[model samples]
Target: MKVDFRYLGRSEVREIAGGQALSFAPNLARSKVFFDAEIVHPLRFREAICALHDVVVGDLKFKKKDKGAYEAWKRDQAQKQEQVRQTLLDQARMRELAAVVKEPLPKNLKGDFQRMHRLYWDARNKWALELSRNDPELFRHLVPCDPVVTVAPDMVFFECFAKDESSYGFLGVDRGAFRTEAGAGLGTTNVDYSLALYEHFQTLRSYRPTRLLVDPSGFEVNIQGRTDYREEKIDLPASWLRGFGQLQAAMGLPSRRFELSVDVVYSILAFLKRHREKAGPRSLRFQLQPGKPPTVVLEPWGIPIVSHGRAYEGEKAEEIKVWGRRRLAPLARILPLAERFEVMLFGSGLPSVWTARMGEMRMVLALSGWTANDWTRGSNLDQFFADLQADPAAVDKLAGHLEQVRMARLTTLAEQTNVPRSVLMGSLHELARRGQLVYDFSVDAVRWRSILPVALSESMLGPEPAELVAGRRLAADPSTTVEREVMMARGARLVVANVGQSACEAVIDPDGSLTRAKCGCSFFYKNKLRAGPCRHLIALRSVARRSVVATTDRSDLTVHLMSGTYAELRAEADKRTVATGYVIEHAWRLAREAIQRTASLADPTQAAGVYRTPAKIPQSLSLPRALVEEIQREAARLDVSVSVVVEAAWSVAADQIRKSSSLLN
Candidate 1:
């Protein structure tokens, strides 16, 4: 599959030597990196990329923009807390120290109580010490710094590199037309010589970019422009496809999604920049009071930064915790240029997504709970599997709709197809992961992009971890059973899956992070849940989650999962208890209901097929009157539509004749 980028620039220019900066595949570690992003203005995007690069090198030094406000807020709260502490001491003295006149209160009591108030302020002060002061002379690794870049319907990936802890740089681009000259299912070559031709277009003084163009050919990549044209093969890694699918799985996971206006986003960014270093709180806490705009509480210091833009209209009162808050600094470059911003928090220390909406473009930053949960280390292997397989029927329907509209928002496509937003989102995500769907950030809709070869394996996303192999082996042993037990005593459903000789209990606190996690494994004992989950815990997480694979194209087929688990909305991780009778009864009832529902929607005019639905439409065949009358009689005898009666008779007769012919052969 060859794809090309055509330059819309107006000026004519002479060719020059290309720089070595843009060898995307060469610069990036293929095994470790794969993401997708779109840029509207190359220069502006270049600026943002440079800023992010500087941040990783620690060269873009920034003092907390809200330092003054933070300090004042800290002082004010401390004074108030001190007064409260004084009153509390007086009360203690009256209650216990009343008989002892010399000692008004316990000597340790005052000091301990005072320390409680300083928890907020002291943490704020420590933010500076916690900041990464190490300066890398060379960019070593782009672990937390990599951003996926795409040119809309076309493709362009820039992989930032680092030589040392401080040194890194790697990225590539198509310096021609965004349209493709080659067809899908072809090969692309990565030749560094394309740079010289790219320089040829850069010299075009009259060249003015009309808009970003992307002509995608599933196979090869061609760089076409007004003055220059080049062709080089591009390789689409399986993991790249899996990266999107895994992301969709996370998006479908249950989480707290909220909107933050540009101003509000800026305030939070500024707050973190100023106080995150000495900020008292390690976590960015969101106080979401029903009907009121969310109040962002700075860590440790307890300094409350209210939203200056939009209000929190959600009636549900929720408190959200976000870790790795400082990782969001890269967004500062684009947030100022964005029209809107939305944040999706998936429990504390889980993956949090920050989406900045530009008019026709979007910038998304998916940060793990910590910098260590890397894209390559595979902390989210479960998500990749869960999102890998999608409903083929939903995919077929979405493809048809996307073909007609070209691009549309999730809601629009969902409405057009009469499919639920959540259900369609699952299929779309799977399609996108399979490289069949191209996400258009400008329209905020997923576009129809076909597989170049028309067939690809799901395993391209890569292999499962060795830990899973061990866990699965233990789970399937005859002597052991990976039984899943659920309890809701603590308001959070607890899942326990036995592995080998020991078992692990895990509870995903709705607030984020495993609030109640205990495993007999030494990993858990040493880490105490801080270093991330053990392999055993990961296996049990799978058991706790249910799976559904659609078997047919019909709107509703006999959908039954193992153990007849209860499913969550857009979530797959919940499985309630199951009983034999309940399972049997529910299965029969749903099948019968689907049949009745299908019957009503079925059309009488459809051609003979296994299952095709359309409304009744009379047609003139101009057949013999005798045949027509006979057909009516047969239809009456069979008690079915005339079309069905005739079609069935013809089908049986044709089958008998074919069988007879086969005997002759």
Candidate 2:
């Protein structure tokens, strides 16, 4: 309820805040440190929070849950494993039972005397706090250097997560580094009291203090705009508040938006200082086109460099490739107070959206992949966005385009909401996940930000109506969906499939601006309606947006989005629902034995019962990506199901196409 941070003082804005005194791996449950103060950014937001906390999901282990389901949850426990092992040895605690080690009870004690020593002391205190947080030579210097602030009366949102929240660290701060105070306000503290309020805002950021008086009744609440701020509120997850509006709308999946300069970031920090032991798929690859310029390459010596300095206008010639190129070394320390360094790629391992700018300040960073993908796989920002559906008429025309301009250009609210600037960019990422909206980065537009604090309410920014979670998941179950109808001539079409596949379709639009509202989902071919309509097209367009579109012709309906061909839309929705059973006569007897074994294959991959009769017209082939990763690593090394090793390699290519079509007829 009280705040201040006025400082012009600027000694490297307090020794460029890389302040150290943080700690959390006392087996993570700390994060409450809300105000170890001082924050103002200018050194590329603390080297993009130490290059996204040097993306460390490192050395995690976990996997112990299944001593045969904890001996079948202790043989159905009615209670008695020595009377709950004497109530977990009298609520143990001689330093948590000498930090655990008694493991001899399963000598075939056919488990079932309840809470088996409280599930073996909660899996031995979660394997001794994941072996003391994966000891990188002794708990790798703890790290959660607590930063999850939120101050707002004009923006100040910081975030950090990883000790396996996969990886993320955001920063917002901006309202010219907010300053104001009257009564009292200062309560969140940790990380050695935020490095002692960044050593008293490093004497006003090592000297930029033109005037300073951040007095909330004084004890130092410093802020000299060069960056080291703190003010937190940890433990926030609803996918980290919808990853602050879907990971800053991953620069709306760029078809290439390069800009570079600052000498292509010192020629990528002199190719990571002459390839410091470069053993990687170490990419940076670019090669885009249109007007041409962005070459990059430096990968396993495919070399290429180019760019006299940013230029890939991109309309076509693409190549992208961008692996965590050393997490853009925190934009090379603000590329000498940057003047342009944007990037928005979407290729190799996904998620990469940098941007620097600096003048009026702008500092984005998204990253998501590399650092051996946090040791091979984990941070996939849940495929960014797929189950969309938030368009309360595009949040009432983005609250009437931020009440007529205070910022909003997605082509001026898709030309004042006739809607379709790729579906008003998922209704401006669902109004930037309900704090109504924000995202200026020095006017890259999207305003009506937030400042909510009169003791914070607006449903604490969590479930901002996406049709109340697709109507409480269609009222909890409603047989997990399956609607289908599709006749077309403009009237009877529905298709809803959820019990296995073919999910999404409901056309005969009475009102829903149904662009053949399809849904076969891969998040609708990666953000088509621009990520905002796929919960079976938001439950069949909220039942066709409550019927009333009177001038029909949504391209004569029947678009049917993706994941389809579900046994030919369930044998055409079982001939208009209910007639031929045995699952549509066993899916038309495997589609007439896959059309009489590839009906004279003129070249269905040079024939082989045309790849084993699994259909009548269910033809969709594209295998060899190194044989689908060797049939997905031999279906996870024979644990099975790469559709049973691709239908047993199409039953040995349908027994070598019935012995080569009986020696060619």
Candidate 3:
């Protein structure tokens, strides 16, 4: 995805008589979203935006150890020590030479030395600043993309995905927090953000009257060829877009929601700051029981931070563990102003969202399962929406309704659309996946905000994983057998199966995720679940799922092309073409190859002269006069019989039928 940003001028803070004006230059290429309002709490807003900036620049991914780094460091240290010694010796000799000559230094020698030192420091600072201003590559390497800003009717929010691609931050300011002076449009756009702008944000204070402006006037002015008119093109990764959508979808799903006091969060942060763990099992274990305050047990140290907020009201007692605990450092900035913290835990080894509510403003930090397990590569999360087939009509209707209302709760949408709650849920998920809608956990409603101006489709997101594709193929094969499947506690299942030559065993959790898996294959041995599940595990899970699907009564299963079996059909086509018996066989081979390449099978009128002879079809279609004449002419031009051309057409049609009729039984 290539995103283009055209800004009239750089975003900056301008000093006024009694306040500051923070003007944000938005991307003109995006939909127009104008917002100009006086910030109610400038200091808190500054801290929150700065926290978002921290998230945007944060990269906690562990770097591989450089083999020669230690040696290089030692050499550099030795050189510095030698230089220092030489400098001291030279200074001592200069002092002795002066004493021998009996020529004393000037009275203002100390002042001269201090002045020279000040000049040198000034020059160095200027050079450093110039380098930062001139170097585009260095600046880009520092900031990946401008923070996405969306101005809704209800509130204004800024979203940013971290450079490591694991963490996501969203800061929302309610409409009540801003005194809107002007602007009527409401949409999402990118605001020009940089380290320099963040420095300007630090100047915000409670006494000063700070005005937050999206600067719609830039769009009004014509500056096509001006020097200040700047344009930037970013080759955005598809994985980044997918991660954004995945997090949005995950937020709307049912999760373990609880409130944690500010002091508990402070304790967790304090422990992390004091001690550094060097071993494994680094996680925050949440123990929740009915009528008891939630207790969070930090792993390895076994330190417990009990919450003093509300007691757990749910019936069952549950324990959930979340990793990537260190990413919570950014929350420390907002702690002073935040009233309370709300945590949403999807599940163990899944994403968790931590939101800090500060009166009218909220800052959300959504972390992936772990530092390395980014949302894009979390294949298990993708499985949750694999079976949710969105109805096109329902999606359009719901989108139309949401567009008019800006934001609405799920029940309100269901009541308005008169669509079933289940169907509407699927449609909303699909809308989020398409980047047309965002679920606002703060307000418990789905807001109409398009992440991208253009329409997004499934194809744009990227292709399915190779392991998933191969696994689906294996699952659809009748020869693949499930040896044993045992029911486990809490809706989990333990399954053992033979996938090809290897025996595989997997323990699936209640959420249909593989908690533990093992296989004889080398891929599984090498990567385990680090690179996602091996094909064997996926096949086993898919086969088990198909068995469950078979017993369920689903009337909505319509006849459609089973894309999974296309590979199988192509394989069979390859085998049958080895010893061709008739002209139809060659046509079938070509048709199958075309299907494999996802070519159009609607038109195959051209005569393929792989076979000289013609094959006849029983009960031939009675074509129109003009169409038959055209077919005859095409066959004649290609030096082939009419029957061969008709057979080629027939083969293509038959292949389409075969593809459409095949299903995962």
Q: Please, what are the lDDT tens digits per residue for candidate 1 over residues 29-105?
A: 11121222222354554444443354334322233476888899889887995897889889987977656866566
- Whose lDDT is greatest here? 3
Mind giving the per-residue lDDT tens digits that candidate 3 earns over 1-665?
55677898889999866788899998899867889889998988999988898898878877778869899988888799589788999999999998878877689988898779868956654654454467633433454767888888878999888877788898999888877466647888888988899999989988989998888977788887775677665655567667756765675445888899999999999899999998979999999998999999999999898999998877679998888898998998899998999999877767888999999999989888888787666634554433445789999998898888888887678888887765666687778777778777777788887877788767787887777788888877777777765444444556788887789988775455676679999987865654567777888887777654223332211111123323333454344321111122233334534433333223343333233332322322322344456556655665655555544544564554345422111
Candidate 1 residue spans exceeding 4 A from truth: 1-241, 271-282, 300-302, 313-316, 358-361, 381-433, 438-445, 449-460, 479-497, 506-665
Estimate the lDDT of model 2: 0.45
Kindly give the stretch of ten consecutive residues in candidate 2 with the minimal lDDT sum: 20-29
Rank candidates, TM-score, best first.
Answer: 3, 1, 2
Clashes of each: 77, 32, 0
lDDT of 3: 0.72
Task: State every prediction's TM-score relative to the real structure.
Answer: 0.47, 0.27, 0.69
Q: List RMSD in Å for every model shown.
A: 22.1, 28.7, 18.4
In terms of TM-score, the best-performing candidate is 3
lDDT of each: 0.45, 0.45, 0.72
Off by over 4 Å in 3: 66-73, 76-143, 252-254, 418-426, 457-459, 481-665
